[model samples]
Target: MRTAYSVETVRAAERSLMARLAEGALMQRAAAGLAAACAQLLRRVYGSRLVLLVGSGDNGGDALYAGARLARRGAGVTAVLLAPERTHQGGLAALRGAGGTVVPGGPESVGAAEEAIRRADLVVDGIVGIGGKGGLRPDAARLAALVGQSRAAVVAVDLPSGVEADTGEVLGPAVRADLTVTFGTHKPALLIDPAREYAGSVRLVDIGLELPGQAELEALQHADVAALLPLPQAESDKYRRGVVGIAAGSARYPGAAVLAVSGALRGGAGAVRYVGPAGEAVIARFPETLVSDTGPAKAGRVQAWVVGPGVGDDAATVAEVLGADVPVLVDADGLRLADRDTVRGRGAPTVMTPHAGEAAALLGVSREEVEGARLAAVRELAARYRATVLLKGSTTLVADAGGGPVLVNATGTPWLATAGSGDVLSGLSGSLLASGLSARDAAGAAAYLHGLAGRYAADGAPAGAHDVANAVPEAWRDVRG
Candidate 1:
């Protein structure tokens, strides 16, 4: 699993390591890694034009030292000092000694920096550090705007300028980098959006910071998911494997039932028992499904239940499913119908899957707020309902009720913004729950598989919910390998 620590945690770790090392040794280690990464990106370093947006902190020092390294390799480097008086003296002296040109960042010197930016092949952004709260200063923002207009490939040092390292919030104007070379470990901003969108692609350059065993956030890779995947044992029968019960679909939205069942069949469940008003429609599409028009009470026994999707105004059905002594996944309309107290009182684990709009409704906020601060929103929802919360979007996040590490997944394409996508995900998550995975693991692993399946189904084109469901096995096999 890939992990990210908060700014405070990172700083503590850095201080601990710095105490053991000689003065300036840690900075030099960081500079060496940064310069090496920049050189690799440039390919041919000789005679290449580079611009460093130098500000006042250690970030500025990192840029200057890295620039000095490139200058020694014959790259023509220009340092645009945002705060000339407060700039790192050691880094400035090093750059000047290595034959780098310096441009003062004042109103009168803006044109000079603009000229260098126009001719630059790569722009290194070191305007603000992780401690930076809201946006950029006026002077730095102007330089960032200029860099945005230029054709240069921008690389940010540590965290991107003007983004919250801990919360992943971008308040105002921030530097958008083509690649960010982060030292030590990842920050929440690098993984969570809308700051994640600002941090284009990330490259971690470890500088040997001794961190705690647990991280604030984590993103599961293929190996991690593969280890958690539920496979059939030789003695396992259909009942032994676990049966998933789906309480979804309505008379008007019968397609939701078929799509949910489709996902369950492909999701490693032995059998899917679907109970809704759209039984005939579900059976017509998937004959393997044990369709029932009766409520969840008479639907035999199931290891897990997935409610909502196209249930519309069926509050009773949602309540009935919630009452069952099994792990439950609530999505779509069920998010609105389900009571908070009742859900919290449940003996078994419950997973809530909500889009931005649904999450906004649950939180009594606007959709824009949830989208803007996804990490905060998901964490809040998980705490409020005392259940595992899965907030779906361009980046899918799974937050556990107890809140150890929030799981982040960025494996799907934008084409996944299709209709009935959530329905498919609901079934998959419920199936994983039935197969004996915890709410957090089930939601995170399901999200990982679902995103990959969407990518396979789309294949650079548009795909329906059915296509995504069909691609689940392929994603499973790919992960296992």
Candidate 2:
């Protein structure tokens, strides 16, 4: 798993490592890594025009020292110092010794800096670090804008400047880098976000800092997903594996039942007991499904239940399933029908899957608000409902009410925004819940597998909801292998 730490945690780790190392040793290690990455990008470092946006902190020092290294290797390097007086004096002396020219930054040198930025073959953004809050200052903002206009590839130090490192919020003007070389550990902004979009591709440089405790957020890798997958044992029987009860679809939309059943069939469940109005449609598509025209209460014994995919006006069915003592997953119209108090009162675990629009409705806010601050929205929904929330979008995030790290699903395609795609996800996750995974694990694993299936189904082409559902077994095998 790829984990991300908050800025506070990273800073504390840095301090601990710095106390044990020589004064300049840590910075030297960082500068060496930065220079090496830049050198690789510039292929021919000799005669390469390099411009470093040097600020007042250690980030600026890193850039200046890196510039010095490049200059010694026969590159023409220039440093535009944003804070001349407060700049790292040692780094400044070293740059001058290595034949790097320095230019003062502010109103007077804006033109000179812009000129250098336009002419440079590469631009290094050290204007701000992870410690910066809000947005870029005026001097930095103008330079950031120029970097956008320039054809030169930009590399950000630590993180893209002007983004919240912990929250992944882009408050104002922020640097957009082709690549970001972060040291020690990954920052939250580099992994989540509106900020993550700014950090194009991230490269971590180990500064040998020891980070303790849990991460703020984590993205499951192949190995992690493989371990979480439920596999059948030699003596496993149908009932022993677990049965998933699906309360979905209505006379108005029978396809929802068919699609949900399609997903449930490949979701590692021993059997799927489906209940509701579209029993015939579900049976037609998946003949193996145990179909029932009765309510969820009459549906045979099940380890877990999936409620509401296309039950347009069937609020009674949603309420009935919520009354059950098994783990339940609520989605689509069910999110609107289920009583908030009853959901909170349930002893069994509950999982909510909502897109930005649905989540906005639950929170009484605009869709833009939820989309703009997805991290906050997911956590708030999970806490308010006292359930695990899977916020589905371009980036799927799963948050638990217990307040641990949120699991981020990074393997999805734009083609996944199909009509019945969410129904498949609901069924898949519900099946995993029935198979003995915790709500958090079930939601995270389902999202990971769903995204991979989407990728496989799409393959740069348009794919429907059934295509995604049909690809689940392939995704399952890919994970297990």
Using lDDT, give the best candidate's number. 1
What does candidate 1's lDDT look like per residue over 1-481, in tens digits? Answer: 8899988899999999999999898999999999998999999999999999999999999999999999999999999999999999999999999999999987889899999999999999988999998899899999999999999999999978999898888999999999999999999999998999899889999899989867989999999999888999999998888899999999899899888888888778889999998899989888988877778999988999999999999999999999999999999989999999999999999999999999999999999999999999999999999999999998899998888999999887787899998899999999999999999999999999999999999999999988999999999999999
List the pairs of residues colliding in candidate 2.
none
lDDT of 2 by residue, 1-481 (tens): 8888988898999899999999989999999999999999999999999999999999999999999999999999999999999999988999999999999879898888888989999999998988999899998998899999999899999999999898888888999999999998889888777788999889999989899999999999889989988889999988888899999998898888888888888889899999988998888888899998778888789999999999998889999999999999999999998889998899999999999999999999999888778889999999999999999998888999889999998788889999999999999999999999999999999999999999999999999999999999999999988
Model 1 whole-model lDDT (C-alpha atoms): 0.93
Off-target runs (Cα >4 Å) in candidate 1 are none
Which regions of candidate 2 fall more than 4 Å away from where they truly are?
none
Q: Give TM-scores for every candidate, taking all chains together and pairing residue i with residue i.
A: 0.99, 0.97
